[model samples]
Target chain A: MEYAYYPGCSLEYSGKPYDKSIREVFKALGVKLRDIKDWNCCGATMYVSIDKIVACSVAARNLALAQNMGCDICAPCNSCYTILRKVNRYLAYDPEMRGKILEVLKAANLTYDTPVDVRHPLDILVNDVGLDTIKEAAPYRFDGLKVAPYYGCQLVRPEHHFDDVDDPMTMDNLLTALGADVVPFASKVRCCGGSLMTTCEEVALDLNNSILKDAEDNGAEIMVTACALCQMNLEGYQKKINKRYSQKHNMPIVFFSQLIGLALGVNPKRLGLQSMLVKPKNLKLIPKGMKVEA
Target chain B: MPSIPPIPEPKRQREADLREAFLKEVAGIPAGEKIKNCIQCGTCTATCPVSRWMDITPRETVALFRAGMLEEILESRTIWICASCYSCTVRCPMGIQVTDLLYALKRLATDKKIYPSRFPAHALSDTFISSLYRFGRIYELELGLRYFLKTHPLKLLANIGFGLLMIIKGRMAILPKRIKKANEVKAIINRAKELEGV
Candidate 1:
């Protein structure tokens, strides 16, 4: 299957591992991802808060570009997925706003004709690729490694088109099919406080601390998430959270793609595993001296 | 004990005027009129992670808006403190769009210039937008440095160790990845701003 990939800004920087692993895993699965040419930022939650019309217009530009490719777009970042989906829904429902946005896009020589679907990678992997195929493609098993699947808020909420917002099970079921033990994580859909980590540090820290603590309490050795911002907030800020709360949780937060890559026998280096701030200590799960043949 | 004269109560006419102005402002925002549907259910406040830090609870903020107390809500620290997580928006039984209302209040606060100066959260929003406008993509290092310099230089110095760690780990790039044909992005932004009359 072929799809247009919009990695968004985070995947280039803080979310590099996600970007790398997703590409590798998709390649292994024989799905072709053509990068959306000349894509700009998705105008994340921050831009939307400042100016809704400008944010929607910015996202609309990316959609118009993807429409040129004649393929449905797959965005790995939840913020990008959420914003793009919201803008599409807004333009589809509100003709007044659509007219205004169209005028702005006309200045850039672009037009969005509602040509394609904007999907998150998780949605494509679970729904389109199918779990049976993922299970069949795996060369290695997780061997009962306990994983907490964090969906975060954006992927499911404010719109429930993909999965059940409150009780999402796509990630959980996908991991289980890959031979990992999926923990009953209660805060799966909780907000990671996103950009608030830089904006309101205390609140963001508190919210993250709760998620980490819940995962730990449920006996999860590692946390797997689909969104770049959620992984960044949950993993990147653990040090500060431990310092502030005097807690001793050291769980490694990993992208779902990284775990799938490992199961599919992709090289660890290709997935950018070493770049994680909190390294997964369960590397011992992989049999010693076993590596993917080049 | 000596009898004290009764304190004069707030005039009813002034209260009505404030309420009317608040309603008018709410009507001006897109989908903002749904805020009047709020039943004072504290679901929003309960769902909010940072409600403890808010000067006015999300439920109370809606009530204030409904009462036409625009000045009080506009001057509140609550709007600035909102994390925009949208937990409250998803959980609201009345489907009040609590998070969007907070964004509306934030815009109003920014327009009135009433938010606390040197507030890092508020400054972060402006810095983020400016970075997007200038480069068509956010430059993380530039955004971080600019935010620190403007919000808290001393704290910036304190966080240099962690920043350096990020650089060493290759989590951050010293240079920004710019989009090709940046002029197109600029044109889109400029046109959108003009459309908004801002």
Candidate 2:
């Protein structure tokens, strides 16, 4: 399968590992990912909160570009996925908003002919490329590594067209297929308090602390998430959370793509494993240069 | 002890004009009309992760909007503190789209310039949007510098250690990656502003 990939700003900066692992895993699975040329920011919640019309127009520009490519766009970041999908839905449903957005697009010499399906990489992996195919591509299994599959809030909430909002199963199913022990984590679909870390440290840290405590209590050696912001908040702010809560929770947070890439026997460095703030100690399970004994 | 005499009622009554004006303003924005459908249920507050920190909970924010207490709600930090996680929207029993309602409140606050001056979120959002406008993409370095300078210059000094570590790890790029036709993006933004009558 082929897709037009839209790696938003986060993937290029703080979320590089996700971008790297996404590319590596797709290559291993014989899938083609074409970059959406000259793509800009997806306006995230920040832009939308400041100005809804401009945010929608900016997102519409991306869809117009993807429509030109004639392939669905796959966004790895949950924020990007949520915003792009929102613009698509709004332009289709609200005629007044559509008229305003189209006027802006016309000035820029762009047109969104039809609504392009905005997909998350997890959706593509499970729905487009079957789990069996992923299993077959993996030359090695995880050796029963315990993982807490965190979906965060954006991917499944508000408009849960693809998965159940309350109880998502795609991440769990995918991880299980890769031979990892998927924990029945209760905070799987909870909010990670994205961007609040900058504005309100106390609240953001408290919410993140709860998520970590739950994952660790569930016996998860590592927490894998599909959203970049969730990974950053949970992993990057571990020390601050520890200091605030007076608890030592050193669980490593990694991207779901990184876990899949490891199972597919792809090189660890290619997946940007070393860049993780908290390294997964169980990474020793997959030894260096180890190959499947076919 | 002798009982005190009953106090007389005040002569003047506060007009409901504030509520009427707020309702009219919200009606002009997309999805803002749904605020009228609120059922006063507290599910939104219960599901909110940071409701404890907010002065007015999501449920109460809607209630305040319904009651036409716009000035009080605007003065509170509840709207700015919302993380836009959408948990409340998903669990809202009335299907009121509480998160978008909060966003509408934020936009209203920003328009009236009613938010706190030293609000870090406002600085961050302004820096992010301005960076996007200038370069057609977010320049992390530029955004970081601008946000720190505007909100907390001393915090920038404290965060230097972490910033250096990220740079060493190749996590942050000093320069932004610009789009090919950035002028076109600027045109789109300008046209959008005109379209919105901003």
Candidate 3:
């Protein structure tokens, strides 16, 4: 499978592990990901609230750039995916808005025929790569692992397309294919409080703590998320809370791709395991040179 | 020696800071101009989730801004209660970006030490900032435990069982991870902080 991957701003700056693991896992699976050429931030989290027209125009510029590249757009970040998908859906469904958007895009010397498909990485892997293909590539089975697959807020919310937004099974199915156990939890659809962490920390943290508490309470060994911000809010913030409270939670977080990389018997170093904040001691079922520090 | 009570904010001075800081913080909002053109429409207030929780309405928030009554508005706990749902943004007839302005107010309040409490929100913000600073990214395990330790230290024992289980399962690694280009990340964060005047 080939895709024009859009990691967005967060992935480029703070989501390096997600970026590395995603590329590594995809490569191991014989999939090719070409990042969108000269892309800019998709004004979803704040711009949309600050200015609607400018936000839509920012998103439109990226979409037009992807469409020009002549391939489907695959966004790994949930906010990026939501903005692109929302804008594309609007352009397709609303002709008047489409005309207005085109007028705005004219300044950038671009026009939208809606050239490329906008998909999340999960949709590409499950829908295009197929489970059977993934199963064949698994060198190690996750027979004993119980993973809590968290989709966060953006992947399936606001509109239904690809899978059930309320409760997604794609990640669960993908993990099961790798031979890992899936811990069913209700916090999957819960919001990570969005960019409230930037503007309002209390609400965002409480919401994050609640979700983490629920995931831990539900017996999830770890939380696997596709959204980079969700991963950051859930994983990166845990240690500060731990140190202040004089506690520790060894619940390591991994991108879906990194786990797949482990299942496929790839080198742990190549999968960017060292980039994780909550480091897990026991990495996988494989007896490879995968380092585990307790 | 007598223990000092929490310092009370001077009403007039707080009001002035609230007005000036709010305007400075929300300066980037495109809808800021339209906010002054508001015709007393209740559309934004009707759509706000925090409306029922606080005395200040969304329209009233903008009204306060127009009247230079920002200090009283800031003193209220209502700023912390907004969810930033964008529902008000979508409904405003005057196209005022109430949600974005709310964020500006929060940034100002937090930076100026105007917060009401540290039990939940302030502590969470500290963690959020630390996570980004520690690892150029998010780590779920760290975030959860940190919240427990800071907000409810007594609950620390609860996560020990899971922590041990994770270790036994070979899923948890104890060593902290760092970016290969740590200084580059530090620079980025510094730049953002400088932009926010922090």
Candidate 4:
């Protein structure tokens, strides 16, 4: 299957591992991800909070570009996925919003006729690609590696299009299919407080602390997530959370795509494993002598 | 975090226009007006991860909003503290768009220029938009530096080591990768702003 891939800004930068692994994993599965040329930001959560019309109009620009590719667009970032989906929802339901976005697009000399479907990598892998396909395609296994699936908030909540919001099993099921010991994490669908890590440090820290504490308490050796912000917040500020809460949280947070890549026997460097702040101490390589972690 | 002022007591005639504006805009959000169905069950507040940081609970924000106390809701730290996790939105018994309403409230407060003084979250939004307009994509390093400089310079100084580490690890770019159609993107945004202003 082919998709117009829109890697939101975070994936292009701090979330590079997510972007890299997503591309590599899809390639291994023989799926095509065509980059949406000249795609800009999806306006993220900040844009909607400031100006909804402006945000939708900006997001519409990306959709218009993706439509040029004549296929549904796949966005890896949870925020981008949600924002793009939201704009589509608004376009279909809210005529006023639709009219304004159209007007703005018209001024830019662009037109978006068909609304494109924005799919997450998880949805594509577990649902569309199917576990059976992955089972055959994947040559390696987690070998009972302990993992906690952190869905973050945006992927499943506010809309239950693909997975259950509170008790999502898409990632858990996918990991199990890859031979990992999927740990039961109660706060799996919890918030990471996103940019508040920089904005409101203490409050954001508290939120991250609880998430990390749960994963650790659940006996997870590492945490895997789909959202860029979730990975960044949980992994980067883990040091601060440990300092403040005085709890030892050394679990490595990596993208689900990265873990999938490893299980598929893709090169660890290609998956950006070395970029993690906290190294994956418990990860074991399938072929032996190739593990990047401690 | 900026210190939120004490919640305002209702001054009826003086703030009717504010309430009307909030209601009209909020009505446009999907199931947004279902806030009227809120039974003050505190489900939203209970679901919120950072509700303790909020001056007004999510349920109370709706109660005050439905009671036409727009100023009090606006003045509270509740909206800013909302990470927009949507845990409350999906779990609300009345199907209220609790988180979406909070987004609307944030925009309204920003438009009126009346949020708590020096609110850092506002700086984050400001820096993100400015970066988006300039390069058509967010430059993470620059966004973080600008955000800290605007909101907390001392923290920026403290994190210099970590910043360098990020760059060395190739996780962050030293310079932004500009989109070829930045001008085109800017034109769309500018036009949208003008059209919305009307």
Instruction: Name the candidate that leads on DockQ.
Output: 4
What does DockQ come to for candidate 3?
Answer: 0.05
TM-score of 2: 0.93
Cα misplacement distance, residue B20 of candidate 3 (Å) = 28
What would the TM-score be for candidate 1 when compared with the true structure?
0.92
lDDT of 3 by residue, B51-111 (tens): 6655577778777777766765666666766655455665677777676677667666655
lDDT of 4 by residue, A1-294 (tens): 989999999888789999999999999999999999889998898998888889899999999888879788899999999999999998998888888899899877899888899999899988889999997877777766899999999999789989998999999999998878898899999899987887788999998999888888888999999998999899988777888888888889999999889888899999999898999886875643334343
Superior by DockQ: candidate 3 or candidate 4: 4
Please give the fraction of native interface contacts (Cα pairs under 8 Å between A and B) kept by each candidate: 0.68, 0.71, 0.02, 0.79
Put down candidate 3 lDDT per residue, A123-187, tens digits, no spaces: 88899989998888777777657788888766875446687755789999998887677887887
Candidate 1, superposed: residue stretches over 4 Å from native: A284-294, B1-32
Error of 4 at A232 (Å): 0.7
TM-score head-to-head 1 vs 2, winner: 2
TM-score of each candidate structure, all chains considered together: 0.92, 0.93, 0.63, 0.95
What's the lDDT for all of these models? 0.84, 0.83, 0.67, 0.88
True contacts kept of 3: 0.02
Once superposed on the true structure, which residue ranges of model 4 sit more than 4 Å away at CA? A287-294, B1-13
Give candidate 2 misplaced runs (Cα > 4 Å).
A284-294, B1-32
Task: Report DockQ per prediction, comma-separated.
Answer: 0.58, 0.63, 0.05, 0.73
List of clashing residue pairs for candidate 2: none
Model 4 residue A174 lDDT score: 93
